[model samples]
Target: MFSKKWMNKSTNDYWDKISNLKKTIENADAIIIGAGAGLSTSAGLEYSGKRFFVHFSDFADKYGLQDMYSAGFYPFETLEEY
Candidate 1:
């Protein structure tokens, strides 16, 4: 278990944060991580560019969607349309 003091240390030092994270991982019994689309995007799963244009060109044409992220909020009239 992580100490509250350790978790609450607000530091802007990048290497310090990495060291703390390393120690935390090393000491942990198990680890569970929750990540969002941004993580995938960082790992090269792009939301836009040629990939979006190729895969979602029809959706972009019909709904005026700009990217995969914005398309999620598009209010389609029915499930089939979505």
Candidate 2:
């Protein structure tokens, strides 16, 4: 379990790490990046709460999808449904 104090410390540590990483990326001649959940969220591809409801309300209503992650694995009857 995470306490508030621990969470704050972790957050500060992460920001410090990212700041250093930004400097490295800026100085590097070339860089490669791996993308996943964090990158997707950063790029505004989040699929829950307000964003999900706003963009995919029709899909959610028809398929009972709670989140976009689950929708990726859901089996639909037609290409249109998918």
Candidate 3:
């Protein structure tokens, strides 16, 4: 299982937090963007619902896997199951 390092993380309301983020970005002399796989997913680019059903119908039928996010953590009994 993963550690709970984020257990104490908190955030303000969306508008307030986004406004501050926008200001911070605008005022920065340099900005860095990380291209981690989950970044786009976290920003709402999900592979779920109809997309998941279309691509992984077999997984859905066999294991009731609903979404790509959950599938990553699913303990399939075998590699073929995965």
Best by lDDT: 1
RMSD of each: 8.7, 7.2, 10.7
lDDT by residue for model 1 over 1-82, one digit each (tens)? 7666645445565778789899999999999989987789789898888999999999999999989999999999999988
Q: So what's the TM-score on candidate 1?
A: 0.57
lDDT of 3 by residue, 1-82 (tens): 9987766544553678889889999999999886986888888787789989999999888888899889988998889866
How accurate locally is residue 51 in candidate 2, as Cα lDDT from 0 to 100?
83
- Global lDDT of each model? 0.88, 0.86, 0.84
Looking at model 1, residue 27 earns an lDDT score of: 100
Best by TM-score: 1
- Whole-model lDDT, model 2: 0.86
RMSD of 2: 7.2
lDDT of 1 at 36: 85
Candidate 2, 61: how far from true, in Å?
0.7
For candidate 1, the lDDT comes to: 0.88
